[model samples]
Target: MNNPFPYSEDNKRYYTWSHYLKTKYKNKVFKVALNANFTCPNRDGTCGVGGCTFCSSYGSGDTIEDKFEPLDVQYESNLKIMQHKWPKGNAIAYFQAYTNTYGSVKQVSEMLKPFLFKDEIVAISLATRADCLSDEMIEYLDFVSRKKDIWIELGLQTTNDKIAKSLNRGHDYQCFLETVERLSKTNLKICVHLMNSLPGESKEDMIQNAYKVGQLPIHAIKIHMLYILKDTVLGKSYLQHPFPMLDKDDYIDVVVSQLEVLPKHIIIQRLTGDGMRGEQIGSEWMFKKTIVLNDIDKAMVARNTWQGKVLETK
Candidate 1:
């Protein structure tokens, strides 16, 4: 069958990160997840406490193999492991742990300066919150982006402010919009993270989130199903009184619908998340990452739909 999507090298119906990197850089590219030893405002008593209800004790950095090591050591160790697969590939230094931009301008600069000059490092990705970004921090990041590709990853798990408050997210949807507006004037690329199946949200609510953000000035997005892990508030609560969650087939359906609404030019960084084994308490279906992604592909093909299908009609 012919692939209707114009941006894909393979038969994928949506724009993929691999296609974006291969077309731009002409080589394999991967992210080396690093723990920058930063803490969030909510976790450190600046706003609230205990972090997000779903965040684990590692602040969602459980996948970082050498998280406890120094930043340089952590980057070198992980990059070497990834290069064993793609021997000549370049890397994006991903600050995957807590709020990477929660510190002062000097602290953030010190953390990123070493990696900026490395030849093998092609870009830097920092996962941060909207309320944490100060004017000075934004200026510094914008300045550094002139030297190297800078990606500021903001987590807006859901658009519903009520749901956000229930999870103790610290900030609301308005904060995210303001932050994106500020970053839009800079050279930095913005990637927003959205999670489906958050507590108290419906399938329509999830699709609406895609519709709204797809109209923004975002360069990319990462969507994943929420997985409850042990040692977290949500996990402990689920153990006592479980809430309804989406099954595999329903999750694929929602993901395909999300893609249909999203613009084709925006890169789909990730469609599914890798839940750390032995720690995840519910949503066990996310363990089969490849199967979930393949099923989403099949669903899109079966419906004869490509990305931006709805937008084209409008």
Candidate 2:
């Protein structure tokens, strides 16, 4: 593959997270996802109720194993999978379920304490909402960022407040901005999650959100298309009245356009995300994830473009 991006080994036209990890660790590093047994404010009525309309029962940590087991057991279980996938690789324990830092700073600390001592764990990734973070949480995360690699994945979805309201996102755009500003002070690697083809959002809306997050001090991003899952609010709505979804071709175009508008230095963590085959309902294109990603790569090459290719240089 022609890796013209200069930051990857494949034909990917953007800076890939895998490339960055390998370069930083000098070898392959995997994130062994763990279920920390946390709940979201959206689900618990702190922010609203019933959680985001699209979230699954696993709190988006569906890949995590042994939810009922201790952290040590979960770590070893995921480690075995990673070892088989990449036998020579190092790893980091990823606290991926719900609002990992929603609890008190002390509680969050205890959940992370075991992973801190693991020689094989090179970094820690926290997946949570920006508004869920408190001052105490930020202070503790900042402290850990100084000691080891601490990457925070904030679920921004889209910066459009209207869409946020429609999805029952609980927080507004300003809240996400404020949260980013706070985390910026710590200088930790931040990755934002973005969604495409959301209800009531046009293609332009997604591109503008891409432009906005690109201007932030974020180090990476994960781009996902909205997928309606069964037993959720979105699923109920879809059953009542089906909403338009991006097809495979349209999705690839949107993803490529997002990449073109983003800053080249921002690592592309994932091009798209998926729910379980059985649970996922809308956006049937999600089933062909590999093909969709390949299409994006091929489209970028055909257009002779790459990340930041459309951005105006100062």
Candidate 3:
């Protein structure tokens, strides 16, 4: 079968966003958001205590905090960014805020209808949770998929039950599996969010978790380094325990190893994440983010490794 990932050229992985967009559309496409203003279960007390251990109210908003304009404004501005950069390209209105599918089906459809009318928006990507993936929601997703490309992003931060509970993600591996099964039965594409070097998680655990994720029916993977942002539950825990974030070299080694085991066919949406400068609570290495990504690429090249090498052995 042909590789479905937009960026799979020459059977090698492409890592840049622009490259991925070009490859996906055979031209260019931007990810704009309609911002449905959905709330997360974690914050609503339906899940557990506070939100995910590493997630703050801003939802790791640092690089684009200033870009948090109104829904229409956000979409228009993002579209402008894409048009200015890739003049011939199109855009996708991605409902990227927390739990986009958490609202009623009618509400979601009504909110998203405006974007669908635009010629520039060829698809929609909804960032949501597994537990929130209801039958009605899947129906809506299938409905949207028929009109345009539909991508649903699920955060399965780690498969480790211990870490899931510790992070208060409020869902289990079973929940994630069920959600993927449901979506796979339909036509919606799936992307996953994972974090590495989280407190109380080990290198072995991270590798094992990635292997488990590889087994799931996912089309893309996004990996982010753990950050203890201030004013969050995880930040408070860090203050109490003072655990170390991954060192630059160690983090790169782990990321490279993970990539080696991750399916090369899967699109890599992100390699590193940015935390708010004032909110970042650990790791001097994080001060220079590119230093981390540069080291990861160099190490991968030197080792001649990609995401699924080690997993194949197992």
Candidate 4:
């Protein structure tokens, strides 16, 4: 069957990040994940304590081989690994670990200045919290974006305030909306993260979370499944008192529904996430990422739907 999605070049019913980068750069482009050694307000005393219930001790930097190394060293090492796969591709300097923007503007400037002029770097993506972005930081990012593409990745796992509180997420939906509005006026691109199967969140809740955020002036979205890790608060709680998690079939169903609601223009950066094999306590089905993604594509074809189908109907 032919793919109906305007932004896709293959059978994908959703707009993939690969398609976006290829179209923009006119060649292969990959992200090099870097750890800036920043901390989150949720982890420190600034917001609350113990970090997010689902986050691991590495602040979700489990994939980084040596996170404690200096930024230049980390970038060179990770870039080599990525280049081994796509030798001709350009790189996006992805600040993936912790709240990269939680520090002072000067600290953030110093951390990012070197990469801004690097020949191999095409863009810089910073993973941060909505509350961490100050006006000064936004302005600085906007100024720098004039020279290079700057992407601000904000983690808003779920839209439900009750679920947000239960997860110990420092801010509410309002805070996310306010931050997005502020960032919308800048040259920076925005990517919001959402999670399915959050505790107490139904399939309908997950769909609405995508629908609500889809209406915002965001450039992209990353939809992840809530995988339990052994070291997290959620993991300990689950070990003591088990809660229901989405099986592979159900997860595929929910993800396909989420894609139908999101606009075709917004890039779908990630459909699922990888959990450290030794550290994961539940959701074993997530390990088979390829099969899960294939099933989602098959389901979308069977349903005769594409991304933004529901939006067009509305």
Give candidates' CA RMSD values in order. 0.8, 1.6, 3.5, 0.9
How well is each residue in 1-314 modelled by candidate 3, as lDDT tens digits?
Answer: 34333444544333455566676677667776555566788878898656787877754433442246767777777677767887877887777767888878988888777777787777788888899989998988798788788889998899877879889899998899988999988999899988988777889888777777877778888888887787888888788889867877888877787776776566777788767778788676776867777777667667766556665567
Give, for candidate 2, the lowest lDDT window spanning 10 residues.
Answer: 1-10
Clash counts for all predictions: 0, 0, 10, 0
lDDT of 4 by residue, 41-139 (tens): 989988899999999888989899668999899999999999999998899999999999999999999999999999878999999999999999999
Candidate 1, after superposition: displacement of residue 284 in Å? 2.2
lDDT-based ranking:
4, 1, 2, 3
Give the alpha-carbon lDDT of every model.
Answer: 0.92, 0.86, 0.76, 0.92
> Per-residue error at 77 for model 4, in Å?
0.7
- Which runs of model 4 end up more than 4 angstroms from their true locations? none
TM-score of each: 0.98, 0.96, 0.89, 0.98
Off by over 4 Å in 2: 1-4
RMSD of 4: 0.9
Per-residue lDDT tens digits for candidate 2, residues 1-314, read: 36557775755789988888878999899889888889999989898888888887788877678876888898898899999989988997788888898899889899888877777888999999988889888988888776678899998899989889888889998999998999898857799999898888888888999999999998999998888888788888888999888888888888888998999899999998788888888567787878888888889988888899889454
Question: lDDT of candidate 3?
Answer: 0.76
Candidate 4 has an lDDT of 0.92
The 10-residue segment with the lowest total lDDT in model 4:
1-10
lDDT of 4 at 54: 92
